[model samples]
Target: MQAVMKNVDCIIEVHDSRIPFSGRNSEFEYTIGGRPKILILNKADLADMSCRKQVVDKLKRDGCSRVLFSDCKHDSTNIIKKILPSIQELIHDAGRYHRAENRDYNVLVCGVPNVGKSSLTNAIRHKYLRAGKATQVGPTAGVTRSVLEKIRVCDEPLTYILDTPGVLAPNVRNVEVGMKLALCATLQDHLVGETIIADYLLYWMNRHRRFEYVEHFGLKEPTDNITELLVPIAIHSNKIQKIRTSEGRYEYKPNISQAARVVMAAFRTGKLGKFMLDDDALDSLSEPAVADNAGDARHRS
Candidate 1:
């Protein structure tokens, strides 16, 4: 990436909008810094759009100048259009000493795993050049094995983008952060366990008073008990698994694991509802002094 950075004109760091702060590769600050960078929060359709202002403000204060919400899966999110103009504006205003003579734009699409880096790339490609998918899109992490060759997304000014493999942070120490990343499908479902992820989803929605899951999942009401949620779903959906006891006798039982996966799949596909996983962090923007004090303490420690 360092070698390719010389020819790259701008950087677009894509992240799951559901978690604007969680699981972001902090190493990007040192590796992809000093260039005109745009923080593209993809999966905007699943995010809390109301917190857009606060998230953008917080990112700008953290040194990122531009932050855009995008939903590559939907046709209405013409965020692809905003991207081209924004890229032109950001590049035109910044110094391009290495490639000053080049008229075409070369962008680098990078971010943590499964945050729609390839989807955004394909969206932009289709938006401008009316082309098909430039790269493979997957639900799990580490799908793109390497930095791909430049894919042309536009022709007017001749824009090309190098889609790189998603880079997760070296240390994800916070359990809550890991859960959020898992819920967003940045990590594989097996990594965090489907039941645990479903439980977290229920807990988050109940805490936030987002009870759309209740109606969607045929629950009588929102409950903290994951077993209570899964048992009914498993029976209704017939998610049963054949289990063999220690005596070697086979019996059919409600497959809560498969039920949990159903819940996860619904949430991922936005069937549960639009969820802003980082609402607590976004709300803190209203109290900068408290955040600054915590920052100070961390720095001091």
Candidate 2:
């Protein structure tokens, strides 16, 4: 991150607004330190608007640098256009004053998993005439691999971009959370594994959602509680070779094996109703007051 920031005049931190906290790589903050940065909240369409409002408010109080909401999956070029000129100026100044070499300014695009970093890169690549380079193409045709990738959008008026992987934080618990992050590394297009886990939990939450959970599992009896219904399901599915509950009425064994299968299925499919693991309010940081000089130093000093 530090190298990218040092290489580029401006650093844009892209993140999924739905899971801001999850998407943020705390380490990057230390790497970039206080370099001129723009916080981009991507996938705004999937996130909660009220929460984003709060995050915007909060960002303002925390130095109010710059924040933009975007939907990379859709048309979000307007926001990029608004921020581009100032960013270009910052790069130009860096190349002219800060750097000793006659090279173009680099702009690093850093973000967490599935936040649309690649999509955003493509968007910017389309606009700028001198766009440096679109992610360095590897030897393999059509197959893409992640390795601190970079793209050149322009030549004479140079501006390079580095696309980073999803941020990984220690605070992130749950194996499912990790699996979701796996979307960054794996080639699979669907979040099948995450959905399987989610479907299981959702099954418990809403029994009606999955007919197999109750019908094929012999849980049709209205009197059967969650555990009771689960045991037979697990036994029938061969998840457990054998089943033996405690002999006494005082003891009851809840069925976890069945739940495990459900969880496993969620992971196999991205069926979990567009789950956003991160707190949405992280974007509520207030907008910083617009710079007074519209002509000068819009993003960097």
Q: Pick the candidate with the highest TM-score.
A: 1
lDDT of 1 by residue, 1-301 (tens): 8778888889998898888877777677787658899999988888768778888888788787889889888947677889988998889899787799998999998887888989899998988888898798987887888666589999988889999887545236598888998998888889889999999988888878889988998878789999999999999999988989999999999999899999999999989888778777765556556558777685465
Per-residue alpha-carbon lDDT of candidate 2 for residues 112-216, written as tens digits (9 for 90 to 100): 444567667766776666344365422111223475677776564666677765432323455544444443222133334433443434443353233433443
Each model's C-alpha lDDT? 0.85, 0.54
Please give the RMSD of candidate 1 to the true structure.
Answer: 4.4
Off by over 4 Å in 1: 168-173, 287-301
How many pairs of residues collide in model 1? 0
Query: Model 1: which residue pairs collide?
Result: none
TM-score of every model? 0.91, 0.55
**In model 1, what lDDT does residue 67 have?**
90
